[model samples]
Target: MSIKPLYRSCDSQGASQRSDELRTYAASLIPTLKARAAETARLGYLPSETIQDLEAGGLFGLTTPRKYGGEPVSTRAFLDIVTELGRGDTSVAWVVTLLNVSTWGAATFFGEEAADEVFGGNQPARVAGVLTPRKAVVKKVDGGFLIEEGLWGFNSGIYHANWDMLSIPIVDADGKVLDYGFAMVPKADVEILNDWNVVAIQGSGSSSVAVKNLFVPDSRVTPLSRSIGGDYPSTHLADESLFRTANMPLAALVLTFPALGNGYAALETFIASLPRRGIQYTGYSKQDEAPVTHLQLGEASAKLDAARALLTSHADALDTWAASGQYMPFDDRAKVRRDVGFAEKLIWEAVDLLASASGGSLAAATNPLTKIWQDARMASLHGFVVPNTNFETYGRILCGKEPGTLFI
Candidate 1:
């Protein structure tokens, strides 16, 4: 299906308008998404209706390159859209966030040929991935590389995508590792394993996938080291600000929005239930009238507010740096990772506070709070968003130390 661009070229005012319009569109789908939340969980993937609604709205291409008829919005705009969707359904937002960001990664890290193959004819190509180069067996071959065999887990959104963006170590003729990079492979070349059952984000359909004896041409493979801090291979780097955004920072930032959405959903659901619920063992008839309940509500609200504030601050920093056509400095980029982990921590706290106040009945599978709590907790555990790890990384950088990892 051909999707039309929402915004062609624009200044700040125009970009802001486009962002507002996209947010409004996403907001309109909340009711439908909310209604389908249970069905999505039961099916362990997004419903076709939900996918169609998103496609018709042009949301899946938010980060697609303009050359391929995509309307690449600013970092802030992308967050706004994803956060709004998360408020409706955590799994749906998570899938959209990963798919869009992976598409952006394809455009930024690869050459013109790769982009043409993925985003050709204005087609909304959904790219899903497990970008960590873990347990991949590869051999350097003539003109390209051959992935002998590998099993990759946590392949989010792969069920609905046409391509998988995988990471592998570049090897020499003697099987010596030279570098680590991403390989763009068609979905048909990989074997999908039906093993996505999990406690949270069930609708994400994050199935495990495998590949064996798959050949990737040189054009579709790019090293991670060169694309770390906006040193990308895409020719559009000079013309497109979105392509110039810091690579790892942008990738890390995309992970936190679904958690942010969970915070909003949990608060709204808990508050709406207050009038109908009571402190089961207490003398207070209505939970909202109790002092303890008030305290919990107030604290959770504050945490949610603080989380949103942190996300906005970092997103603006990314946008500002991209606008200047310069790479975000190492210190600032590390801070983005720190902020993301910290923000997810705050959101998780907020969700936990509300869940605790929800009484014992929340354990029921039918309760929305149950799923929200599980999903938020799961999102917090992601390696990039783990609060203490990111804190240590940022702290080390501040103390004149190396980041200890290549992702930064």
Candidate 2:
């Protein structure tokens, strides 16, 4: 069950060289991932072989601390690797992104003992969790807190994770809500309800998990508000800049890559199929020979390019702030939220255009384009990345009003 690091002496390699090697490794898995896409969907989770391939590639540790033999890759580098994986299969890419993002959050915010428990082992840790608490009850105890009872839904990547980072509301002796914090708990302590039947992103296996009377030590918990404001408890902040980046912006930006990947794959799939297909009821024997086809392809490609530019810019900004040893300001973070939402919207629009231009044949369940379109649309619907909500929040901030959500 132990997973070894991809390269033992990664410190000897330049950042650019290390990034390129990781991206190349992800690209090399596309063929195998594509071959299993159908099986992944049918099973409602990534196949075991796909998980093994990712582990061998050292992808799970992309966001892990170097002390634990992880890369702690830059936000931009992590985004690039996820995009490459997305090109292979959006759901598979999505799961990997969630695992890494959760791992990053855990390592950055929680105490060192918690980090060691999760990532210090020979086997790389995959953490899956949700920020919202549902039906949760907590109580103060001698050394820590007890869950009492709780349920957290949409636990993406839960199927593969050995630990979970759950959000909970701290309470006083009178049961009055004191503060909110995240609880690090072993997966074995919770009950997983495998009810993630959905129309899109089926392979993500985002099932619900429940915990009853669980005891969480104080060392495994971290305050939520301070962490969101860029104050963390991890001692690595002095040496590692990656842990200094703002949390919300990084979370929002990472979700958008799945859509970007779908756009890339959809465009690739449509272009590859164009030469052999004919325009229905038209004079043109080849779809590629038609003027309308050119327009559609042009528009889709342009949208994708714009999305990539926006997402990359947002990531670079986070890196810049992290390097400067400053927390990203509220207004800047608000803009990041807006940018991520818009980027996903553009990607969804692009994929939809490609799907439409491909004709009715793409409606088939067996077609890759069909899944790509569905997954892209699903990515846009996420609450954190929704275009309308994010746009409104940014607009509010611009109008000298509150962003209205703590998530920013």
Candidate 3:
């Protein structure tokens, strides 16, 4: 059976205008988010009101296909929204990023039946995914595969999603491995585990999920190879630029934006406190009056700016390739991984500098800077942001050697 595509193209000018509107809307919510940051942390997840606000504002569907009542905004616009949200609260931003990115992935890779099940309604669907395979048991059936059992951890935003995507290893009747694929399962079929307790980004609700003997139809599964190569299942949306984006690079890049936002928030928090803050017996009435403070602030600002530059540059490059209907080369993808990691490093450095300069006062749990600092540190520890791995991969690629990783 042939499946119809669910996509509509917007002119560049129209898309940009819509993106600006979304950005403006996201910016307007920062104050409210900042006000509820502590409460969100306390709850270990985003407040219902905050989730409703984001949903009503269409932030959750930023990258969804327009046919599904989504804005389907540009990558730059998506990044801007994420960064702005992160500036308010990293936890909220991280959850939103994970939700939106997973939605985008579902739209791009899932078969039409699954896409319709997810995005066919009046409202946009919230989707979350964990790509890392965990205790997955795949058994082939006549029509689909029986996922007897599976457990995926670090499933950010799963608490709020209507659907979840999980990685599975495909096997034949003989139990020989065939390929790695993703399965789109409804939220009702899975069990959420209370395992999200963490010191940073605590409100993200990134917990573990367990599935027992779930049957997924073949139409809803997508092979990792096809997604990585941009050979998506949604032929109806195949012509859409955003859907054509390279999957692995997009995954690597989305994880970096929250860190960027956290960095910006840290800088702002530190600067705002400088007027009344003292240097702790350094003979300075205000920390801002000290020359050393000036140097530290300037250095942190520059580092953050550099990180933003790298992030936006790579974002634009990805968009350019998508819009031009060209595949992003492997080498370029490797460089993007390296650039994202480097950007993360710079963001963390800026946060650390600002936190150190703010002194022991920031040790208070109530201090917003403390949360931002902790969030940045924790976010930088993500696999995608590991400096050594990315740098080594890029170096290997440059040296004409194979990058030992699959998700280039």
TM-score versus the correct structure, for each prediction: 0.95, 0.95, 0.96
lDDT of 2 by residue, 142-178 (tens): 8889999999999999999988999999877778888
TM-score of 3: 0.96
What tens-digit string does per-residue lDDT give for candidate 3 at 1-408?
111111122338888778778777877888999999889988888999999999888888887887776678777777887888888899999999999999998899887888888888655688899998669988999888899989999999998998898999988888787889889988889899979889999999999999988999988888888888878888778667888888888899989888988888888888888888888767998888899999998899889888887878778888889989888998788889999889999999999999988788877988889999999999999998898889999888888888888888
lDDT accuracy of residue 399 in candidate 2: 90
CA lDDT, candidate 1, residue 382 = 90
lDDT of each: 0.86, 0.86, 0.86
Candidate 1's residue-wise lDDT over 1-408, tens digit each?
111122222328877787778878987898899999989988898999999999988888888877877777888888888888988999999999999888888888998888888777444778988878547999989999999998889888988888889999988989999988899998878888989889899999988899988999999999889989567889754688888889888999889988887788898889888889988777999998999988998899888888887887788888889889889998889888999888988999999999988879778988989999999999999998999999999888889988898887
Name the lDDT value of residue 101 in candidate 1. 89
